[model samples]
Target chain A: MNEKLHPFHIMILIYMNQTGVVIMSLPHLLAENFGYNGWLGVILISLVVNLNIFIISIVYRLGKGKSIFQIMESSLPRVITFPIYMILIGVWSMTGCMVIKNYVYIYQIMSYNTTHAMLLKLLIDIIAYLLIIKGIYTISKAATSFFWITSWMLLLQLFFIKDFEWARLTPFLFKGDTHFLTGGFIVFTAFLGYELCFMLFPYADNPKKFIKSVYKGNLITTLTYLIFCLICFGFYSFEQIRNMMYPLLDLLSYIRLPFIERIENLLFGFFLFTTIVSVVLYSWSAQETFARIVPKANKKVLAFIILTFGYIVAWFPDTLSEVGQWLQYLGYAELGVAFGLPLLLILILVIHKGAKPS
Target chain B: MRTMPKAAALLLVIVIIAGCGDQRILEKQGFIQSTGYDLNGTKNDEKDNRLMITVDIPKSDPEQRMQRETLTAIAHSSKEAKILFAGQTELSLVSGQLRSTLFGVSLAKTGIWKHIDTLVRDPSISQRVKIVVVNGRAHDLLVRDYPQHPRAGQYIDRMLEKESALMSFPLVTIYDFSRDYFDDGIEPIAPIIRENKKNISFDGIALFKKDRYITKIESKQSLIFSMMKQNFKKGEISMKLGDGSKKQEYLLFSSVISNRNVKVKRSTKGNFNIQINIVVKGSVLEYSGSHELSKDYDRKKIEKRMAEYIENEAAALMATMQKHNVDSLGIGRNVRNSLSYEEWNKLDWNKEYPDADIRISARIVIKDFGKFK
Candidate 1:
């Protein structure tokens, strides 16, 4: 392939992936565990997640000439790498569909209904399949275009600034040791997309700047999470934050302009774009990994098969609450893959380095 | 040709699905703009969960004057009441545009949290819906027609909106009320309104002890309480000036800009004392005092007197709220944040609130002796 992704493109891709449907539930999670000290908790977790990204960065640095899948195939025995790839593909495919299920749930409640949930899920799957088959270069180009326009959604929080009560965060760090740590753990779930770092490593044209690009992406997302956490915390009392299911959408409902009515409904439609990109990234990663098992097949065909698998996973949940439980399971599985794989990959590199001729 | 035909069939199916939305046209749907709830029976009827609900909907015709329809029913919940209303009304009753919900004094004092759950659960209702407490049966106020004001929903909405903006009272949306209700150390308060022979108007604020309304602050000093909680812009604070011997006895300050700073201090004995300082900057719209307007010392004396009066009034307002054991000012919230979680949970702020040593002071500055001086 002549076309290669720039480090900047990789950064934008990872950035988009980190901040999808998960941001809606974040403030409530933090507030449930930590009281007014939720802001501090968010900052602490962002740093820890950054540390996890550093582990992925080490994987990028060690595997200089190859993709992470290629590196794994070469470095480890088939016994280990095979199960790891299978587990990753399973988790990624389920998680991708889970994002769509969540988006459909939001759509069902917010908009006057038209299509049935199954039909909506199928539509999402088809759109995602079309995009995923276009390959990574095209996906990155889409992400780049999307990163500029959708970022203005952050500016919507500015309308709530006059109503923000800073006292909601006053006398910070008043919570106990256990609550603070637990809050950090909850926030870590929100920063799950950085695991894509390992997958996107070989795509960067200048491989040396890979770490810098990843860090840049992580920082911008961290800053995004931090700004939103502050806005939500300040905009609501601590109790209000606890009761809110989707804080960003609730915040959007407050705005009314001369030109617009029900701004949140419009924005929810806009966030549909972000949700599509997120699912596309995860399912595409799954397709690439699953392609190894059937090397003779076309990747475009493989992507369709993976997209069908996502549709089946999405169908398993009968209701919104059931879907939430499924997402919780996906989140735990993701944590396992996100934290465990990078650390294991880095360890193999360390051992490989130690056993060298020098 | 076969592939193209299959694609077109699929596209048609999807298009049909897209257009088959839950139909709720403006003319066909009854949009409940405002609702009022009153306790159904006598005050002693404890077991009766029944409520009398009154809903007001705006007329669709542009040419019609005072064109609003009201439906009243005895139902168990706001949702049930809506179902009952739909049975009686021509159009389907929906709460999509629910702008105001008022609780009668009897219902409010009994508790409104359970009744408000329907509003919170309904995905269509906006959190911006104004929640108010009416002194008499809210149904009485909801049914009355004002030919001059036309739509009571719009009138009441504009009344609450304008009063809150002008600093007559705080803007207590259901979101705000729930926030304070759910918080550990704070309490919720809402605009208390009552109707007289002349018309319906804002009376004061109804303070709550948890979900139940415990007491109220009169409309006169509501602005002062509002300022203590937050800053107020474009207010008018008028005071009685001279003794009964004087014919002219009032001073009015308009275009008011005021702010408050509340500080909580703890002594070595583990006691919390609150110090509140309110600063008011406004122009003198009118003065009936004997002091010369042009003189500096007289102006200083007037400012000092205004400060003293405001400080006294502040003390009285705090006393009233404290007497009810309501921490509507969020003094307890401040004290809670100052301690660790363990320490905060251990302290019962409600027990401590009524007797807390709180000092309130005011510093008033009159920028203009007359309008645009």
Candidate 2:
């Protein structure tokens, strides 16, 4: 079943998950830290992130057909694998919830002024459940289709080129090196979902092609993110972009289409599509992690259980601002799971001289 | 077979939901085409900072004319003033189609930045809306109707676009005003509108020293001021030139394209000197005499003559602006952006701006003319 997904499909899935919420919020976050040169910080972060992908690909290749979870399970004790998997599942589910909540909040802000919040939550929950039921291959196909949709939507951003002011990107390197370094770290956290590929290594039809997929995915995601950052920088001044909460949405709101009075609504739907794909991919990873931990557990049942739990977790945050605060904390925690866990797992695999190639 | 029914139901439901979102809310919501704010002074034995707000909404007519209505609300805050207008007008003031926000001279003098902030922060209000200051009362600009246009909002909007396009005034949007208001080095300039004989036109540009309207630059000077700051698609300059025999010739040259480059350098006297280089690509439309030599005239001679004329005009304009303490040319911004903080503080930009040696140079390359040379 996993063999059906082409390397391109996997690349689209990974790119969508990494680029969605991160691109929408990173400009505002980096601007708050670095002020005028926040965009420069984003460029530096993209470079570092691409380098990090190279390192991760090296680590994944060193594992030799063993997925990160499998390597962790074999290299470490059963006691450690179960607990670590549980923690990983919890973090993934929380990340999924945050993405859904953020996307829903944006939808509500742009579209339904009078619609009940519960109805929107219910709609998102039902959609997530249906996608989860359809399984990983179907989700990958959906993500592949969405890749084109996102590209076309991105092309519409050219209308705002007339308003682009190069002066807004000026006072280059103004906030100094320390601010840039710190902002880069914050931006690095935004690209956290790249490690999802490490978990899906065993499922890949041609595991040899995993490195190529990861590099292509990272390149596409980085380029897309840079385009968004450039648009935000172009549409608004440095101070205005810095002050904005969701610079992407704010930038979209400024775009006026002839037939579509509010382009933000259409943009909101496109972003929501990406967000849903991201959540589904992460949730599937979490569910599979749980299934691997419990040998007797049914994978389908576990998927359903995890999807329901994710819905409950998403409901915990009553308001958008609270969800944002939770996501910030979750982002910090993801640093450990996304970066530290892989490094540790890779280190242990090397120490034990884990499984050679078939 | 059972799943077939379920899938069909789902598809039907999706189609129905998609069809339900077809309401033209903006049209029904009575779009506030333009808004005006005025200081109504204290009223009724209360120290109420009264505000008069005018909302222009599309009139319910076959002709699609706009109905202009004014609501007087006594409130200490602009937000309250807006809410009061909502109560009086009985229509939710939708700002999505808002063309411009006019501020009366009195209100502008009292510092209307806080009021403007309320409009800027509202997500519903558009940032592209033009912001202007009225020379007389804001109500006059909003209330007066043109026989041709009918709607005051549409009239003011077209007038602003025409004047800005003609290179007579700077196009100042709400976003531009807000950005300049926040930025320290740059000052905001908005078109000032006035009503005379039931017709409206751009009176001048109200120059703001931060939030306060400090001075006004009337028509032709506004053009010269904008020329220094912005690139124009088309501009015309009529110059009076003398022949070798002292016979004067009037040359009408229309610029097809123009670019201005401003550079600020710290002088040895611890002050700043600005150098302006203007490159123009234009065609000679008309000349006083039959001095047609050829299509390819002396490019160097034309450049020199045009350069001298532009330099004198630019220097005079800069001197006049310096006298009025208007830094609309963004000299301070250039200094702050290009220099370090310590170096910027050492030079008093406001004091040195007027007396600073403004050297101007123009390079006019004639592109083409009509049928005549």
Candidate 3:
């Protein structure tokens, strides 16, 4: 399946993974943690995520044409590997659930107002099921199309700068070095999509193009996030920016044209496409891990089960704070897999080479 | 497979559920055009904090001569009053079309930050909606049917928008207010509207020391204030030009081009002196004076005289504002931009601004001084 993805298509998949429901309320998280100095936070987070991507690409070189599953099978025992596979599956499925839940909640707030949560979840699950059954090839093609779907989002930012106060980004010198480090870790979960590169790298048409394509994808995500942060900073007060749960939507409401009354509703409706791609990709990855573990099991059945499990678990969090708590724990686990695993594997490989008298 | 019917049934169920939710029929909902908030009392009682909300909605039939409905209520907050308004209207009222909000003098002085927070939090309201301070009770204006635009909200909104672009007042939106209110070195300023000649008109500018209204400047002073702060698309400055003897005559300077720059520097005593430089380029539209302006030297003399007068007036306005410790001109913001974050945090702007020296100097070019001798 390495031949299925072109190098450029990898960028689209990574971009889709990087941006979604998370970017909607990003200003809230960044401003709460960093104040007027979030530009520094953007720099620091990108630096760390870039380091993670580099290490993962190194792991790919070590794979030596072996898929991640094959590499793990050759290096570790089944007992150790089996639990790791289960954790990955759980992570992918749980994160997909969070994305679905958050996007649905935001949609209700912005559009429907009082939609039945179960119905929204059912609709998303069915769509994701249909797409996931077609597998990665279709998902990648959908992601490529979704790239065009969402490319118009940044145009809204251009019209919005007329209200921007350049002085809002004032006192431009960086002072809070420690706050940047803390803020970097605080928003570490937002940079989770690039971590998918490690698993998806072996599936690229050329693993040699994986590093550059992933970095380019990561760069696009970073710049997009930076623009959003700076625009929110310029357009909103520190306290206002800090308090707004959805600054971008609030900003969109500011754009008053005679023809359109509720632009955010329509925009958020289009954003559902990005969410579909996200949930399907996550469940599809979980599908891959499921097949590797069972080997002889029916994969389509497993994929549907994974998506259904996400839809069911998404309803358990009755409160937003519960979702926050879940995501906080999930963020830590995600960081462990993104950074801790690759670094540990590199160390193990280094020692193994040494012991083998290479 | 036996799953095709199950899938079709599921899809049908989802579609039915989606269409069964709330239907926001446009005609059945009252679209609030403007809102007015005033404090009920003056003390620490809950009644003191009780907010009186006045909302204006226009008639759907455009041909109706008297075309507006005014809803007034007293409640704990704007949100509460909105909920209480359901009893008064046959249609459900929605606030998505809100054009402007006016706060009574007492409410503004008491502090309107919390009220502003409610506006910003509501996703339905537009951030471009103007916020103003009324000279008297806010509800008074909402009830008056002006001759030009019977709806008080549309009248006030159009007046504010036009004046903001073509006259003396600054364009103050909810977005601008929130930005200035939260910044450490600046404070928000909005236009003041008052009952004049049985109709509402822009009276001046309401200045704030933080969120509380401190004082206001009349339209004449507000002209220079607006000029010193932002660029104008077009406006006029009219004033009496001399001592009450023969030189005292009216002059209207129109087609005005002006800009301002503030420089913060250390004086000889190591204290800060902010130098404000203003340049005005305008042609005299009306001159009732007897002075000859055809000569170049006379034109130079008139230009110099106008410059001196503006400089003196602007300086006096700044001195009065400094007496009240108001930084509505953003001098503190300009100075703060020049320092490190630590230094900015350490400096007390409130203390420094009152005692700080401000100098305003102007140069009026008088592009084409009027029609004739």
TM-score winner: 1
DockQ of 2: 0.37
- Per-residue CA lDDT of model 1 for A1-358, tens digit only, reads 5688898988888888888887877888887777665766767777788788777777766766467666666667888877877888888998899889888887788775555787777777777876898888899899888888798988888888887877777565635333665455556767778787677766678877877887888888888888888888877887777777877777767676768545677778877777788889999899989887677999988888887887887888988888877877788888888888878777877877622322
Q: Best by DockQ, which number?
A: 3
Clashes of 1: 0
Candidate no. 2 TM-score? 0.89
Which parts of model 3 have CA positions greater than 4 angstroms off?
A: A172-182, A347-358, B1-13, B42-49, B61-66, B243-246, B267-270, B288-296, B367-373
Chain A TM-score for each of the predictions: 0.93, 0.91, 0.93
Interface RMSD of 3: 2.0
Q: DockQ (Cα-based) per candidate?
A: 0.52, 0.37, 0.60
TM-score of each: 0.94, 0.89, 0.92
Please say which candidate is ahead in TM-score: 2 or 3: 3
> lDDT tens digits, residues B93-127, model 3?
99888889999998899899989998887877887
lDDT of 3 by residue, A97-129 (tens): 877877777777655677776677778888888
Clashes found in each candidate (C-alpha, N, C closer than 3 A): 0, 0, 0
lDDT of 1 by residue, B58-115 (tens): 8786775637789999998878887888889788887778889999999898799987
Residue A338 lDDT in model 3?
90
Alpha carbon lDDT of each predicted model: 0.80, 0.72, 0.80
Better of 1 and 2 by DockQ: 1
